[model samples]
Target: MAKYSRIIAQAGCHIHHAEPAQVYEAWTNPELMKTWMFLSGESRESEAKADVTEGGAWSVVNESQEETYRAYGEYLKIDPPERIEKTLVRKETGGQNEKIKVEINSILNGSQVIVTQDVVFLHHEQLHPKTVEEHLREQRRQTEKYWHEMFSLLSKQLTPS
Candidate 1:
C-alpha cells in the first residue's frame, strides 16, 4: 500500500500603492507574521533567524502557542521581491521522513503566495480508509477569504502618497 496527500492553493493580494519590497517585507517579517498568523492576543513573538541566503537555516518561534516550527533548506531559487523557493519539514514530528516545498511569487500590484503541500501518512496500514477532500476544500476557501481580508487591511495602511 502507498500513502500520499497533496493540496494546492493560490492566494494573492494587490497592494497597488505599495512597492513589492514593502509587501515582501510584510510577508517575511516576524512582526507582521504574528499579526496575521496569530490572532489570539497571546502576545505572540518570533525571532526571524532568517539568513535568506542560498543555503541557510530559517526558524521561527511562537512563545504564546508554546510551539516551534523550524527548517534547514537551501534556497532553490530567490528573486528579490519576486520569488522564493525552499524545502522544509516540521520539527519534533519524528525522524527526517517527509519534505515540503513552498514557493512564493510577487505579482502585479502585489504578490501571490502559492502553497503546495505534500505529506506522507505514517503507519499507512493502521489508518482508516477515509479522506477529508471536501473538508480540505472548504478550509482552502475560508483561508482565501481570510487572506483577502488581511490584504485589505495592509492596503489601507500602505496606500498613501
Candidate 2:
C-alpha cells in the first residue's frame, strides 16, 4: 500500500432487450462471461468460476497467443439483479488491488450497467519506465477499448425484445 495511489476508472453500456437481472446474471455467471473476457479481438479460451456471494471467491483466466492473464478476487457486496462490489487482483498488474463496483439499472426495454473500478498502482517512477501520467493514460485508453468490445459482445448474448 505504501507508494501506491488510487486510480478510479469508469465504463458503462446499455444492453438492449435485456432485463437488469439478466444482465447481472451474465456478469456473475462464469460460462456467459467466457464469451466476452478477451483482452482484444475475438474471444479465446478462457475459464471463470465465481461463488457469487459476499466474501466468496471468484477467478477468471483468459488466454491469448502470447500470454495468460489471471484475475482473482473476493466478493465484497452482492445485491442480486442490481449491484455488486468486489476486490479484483490481476496477475498482469503485479496483483494490484482493484475494487470494482457494478450497477445495473432498469431502462426502456433493456438494462444499463455502470462499472466503477478503483485500482491501486505503484507510483510511475517505481512501476514502469514511462511517466505515471503516461501509464495511466494508456490504461484508460485500453480500458475504454476493452469495455466497448466487451459490452458489444455482451449485448449480443441476450435475446432481443
lDDT per model, in order?
0.51, 0.79
**Leading candidate by TM-score:** 2
Model 2 residue 34 CA deviation (Å) reads 1.2
Q: RMSD (Cα, Å) of candidate 2?
A: 2.9
Off by over 4 Å in 2: 1-3, 123-130, 159-161
Candidate 1 residue-wise lDDT at 129: 44
Scanning candidate 2 in windows of ten residues, the lowest lDDT window is 35-44
Q: List model 1 lDDT by residue over 1-161, tens digit each.
A: 43444344456655665666776665456566444432323535645445566665555444557554343444555566766665545442233333333334556665454444333333344455454455446645764565566556656555675
Residue runs of model 1 more than 4 Å from their true location after superposition:
1-4, 27-43, 65-74, 91-123, 126-161
C-alpha RMSD for every candidate: 4.9, 2.9
lDDT of 2 by residue, 71-153 (tens): 78999999999999999887546667788898999999899989888756556445654566676777766666677777888
Predicted model with the maximum lDDT: 2
